[model samples]
Target: MKRISAVIVNWNDKETLARCIRSLQQQTHGDIEIIVSDNASSDGSQAMVKEQFHETFLIENPDNLGFGTAVNRGFERASGDYLIFLNNDLEFAPDSFAILVDALESVPGIGAVIPKILYSQKQNAINSLGVNIHCTGIAYPRMLDEPDCDDLAPEEVACGGIFMMRREVYEELGGFDEDLFLYHEDHDLSWRIRLAGWRLLTNPRAVFHHRYHFNKGKMKYYHSEKNRLHLLLKYLELKSLVLLAPPLLLVELAQWAHSLMHGWFFLKLKSYGDLLDLLPRILVKRRRLQSRRAVADREIARLFSSDLQISGVQSLALDFFLNPLLKAYWLWIRRYL
Candidate 1:
C-alpha cells in the first residue's frame, strides 16, 4: 500500500483543528502520516496539538506566514507517495482518504482527486465537488449545495481544494504559489497541473464535512476579488483575456454598484484599492507565469466552459427579491435546462 501524508494548516481555530485531527485518526487508510502546520497561532493551537496528538508530526512556525506558504512548509516535511491538503475546519468520513487514493490510482492520468464535501451544519448540503472556470476566467464551486451522492461520477477539471496529489506531480509542477496569500491559490495550482498534462478528478465515494462560515464578511470578499483578478492577469492567454475584458469590466462595475447600495462601500473600495496597491507585484508575477507557459492557448481554452454567463442585474436582483424562487430556478436549470 502506498503511504499517504495528510497536511492540515491551522491558524487559531483550535476546536476545528481538534475535530479534524480526530477524523484523520479514524481514517480507514492506515498507512498514513498526519502533519499539522500551525502558523504561529496565538490561540493555543500549537500547544493543543503538541499535548493531545503528540504521535502526529507538528510544525510550529515562528510567525504567521499565510496559508500557501505554510502548506509549502509542510510539504517539505512530508514523506508519502501521495499528499493530501486538508483544511483545518474540516472532518473526513472514515473512508475518505482510502476512497480518494483509490480513485487517483485507478485513473493513471489523474494527478489529483477531490472528495465530495458536504456542509457540516446542513447535513444534506454540499460544500464543493469540484471547481470549474468560465470563459472570463471566473471560477466557482461546481456543486455548492447539492446532496452528496455518487451521481456526479468521475470528471476532469482545473482543480479542487481538499484534494490529493501524486508526489511526482507535486515535485514537477512545484507546490502552491506562495504569493497567493489565501484565495485562488488552489485554482492557480490546478491550472498549472492541467497545463503540465495531468488530469484532476472528483470522487463522490469519498466524503467530508465542511463548516461553511458564510458570515466571514469583508475579509472573504476582499481575498476573493483580489485573487480572482490576479489569476486572470497571471495565467489567462492574452487573446482570451481580451475577449473576456468587456464582461469582466461589467462584472466589476456591477459589484461596485451593488456594494455601494448595500452599504458595503468600504468593502468595494478595499478590493480596488488593494488591486492598485498590488498592481506592480501582479505585473511581475504575470511576467513570470507567462514565461513558464508550457501549454498552448488552445489547450488552456479547453479547460473553460463557454456556456457560463454572468448577468449583473439578474444576479443582484435575485438576492433581494426572489432568493427562494431563484433557488428553485437554479435547481430546474441544473436538472433539465
Candidate 2:
C-alpha cells in the first residue's frame, strides 16, 4: 500500500476547501495524508483547518501567493511515496486515490497521471480528459464538455497538473515553476517532464469533480501568454526555436488582433514587455534544462497540434486561415526539428 500525500492549494475558498478535505478523508484508500496549503485566506480557512482537521498538515502562507507557490510549500512538507497536487474546489470519489495509485504503478514510464475531471455543475459532462498541446504554445483539455462514458480508458497527454505522481518524479522535476505565479506552470513543468523521458497520462477510472469555470478575462491572457513563452525558451533547443520563430511571430500578431478586438490590447503589450524583461533569466533556466534533458525536440514536436482554438472565442480568420497555415507550417517545420 503506497502512501499518497495530497496537497490542496486554497485561497479564500473556505467552504469548498473543507468539503474537498472531507472528500479526501472518505477515500477508500486509507494510506493518504492531506496537506492544506492556504494562500493567506481571509475567510477563516486556515483557522478551520487548524481547528477541525487537526490531523491534516497546514501551511498558512503570509500572503496570497499564487497556486504553484502554495503547492510548492505543501510539497516541501509532504511525506508520502506518491504526491497529488490539487485545487481546493474539488471532490474525490470514494476510491479515487486507490484507482490513481494503481494507474501510476501500472506504467513504468508514467511520471504523472490525472483523473477524469467532471464538472460539478453539469450532470454528466467531463471537465478534462487529457490536456492537448498546440504548436502555437497553447494547451487545453481535449475532452472538455464531452459526455462522460463509463468505458473511457486511460490515455496519454502532453501534460496534466491536477495530477498524482511518484515522489521521485516530484523530486526530479522540483514541482511547478514558481516564476509562472499563476497560469501555464503545468505546461512548463509538463514539457520538462517529457523532455526528461517521462510520460503523463489520464486515468478515467478515477473520478474527481471540479468547480470548473470558463473565464476569458482578468490576468488570464497575460499570465498564459507570458508563461507559454517562458516554457518555450526553457525546453526548445536553439535549432527548434529558430525554426519555430516564424509561426511564433505570426501567432503574436494574431494574438494582438484578438486582444484589440477584446479590449485587452494593453494587457497583451504588458505581457510582451514582461517577457522581454525576463528574457535573461528565462535563457539561464533554458540552458540548465536543455543540458540535462533526455529527449530531443523532434520527439516532443510530434505531440504538438497545429490548431489554435479557444472555447467560446470565434473568429472567421482564425478558423479558416490561421489554423490551416499553422497546420501546414508545423507539418513542414517539425521535420527539421
Please, what are the lDDT tens digits per residue for candidate 1 over residues 1-337?
A: 9999988999999999999999899999989899999999999988899899988899998888888888898999999999988789898889889988888888888889988889999968887888867654556677776676657787777668778999998898779887778887888888888777788888888888888775446566667777788778777767666655655765576567767765666866787778888888878867876777777656666656543433223463545533344334333332221
lDDT of 2: 0.86
**Could you tell me which 10 consecutive residues in candidate 2 have the lowest summed lDDT?**
303-312
| Candidate 2 residue lDDT tens string, 86-188 | 8888998899899989988888899988899999999989998767778767778878889999998787778785888889988998888888899887777
Error of 1 at 245 (Å): 1.1
Candidate 2 vs. true structure, TM-score:
0.96
On a 0 to 100 scale, what is the lDDT of residue 90 in model 1? Answer: 92
The candidate scoring highest on TM-score is 2
Q: Please provide the root mean square deviation of candidate 2 (C-alpha atoms, Å).
A: 1.3
Which residues of candidate 2, in runs, are more than 4 Å off?
Answer: none
Task: State the weakest 10-residue window (summed lDDT) of model 1.
Answer: 328-337
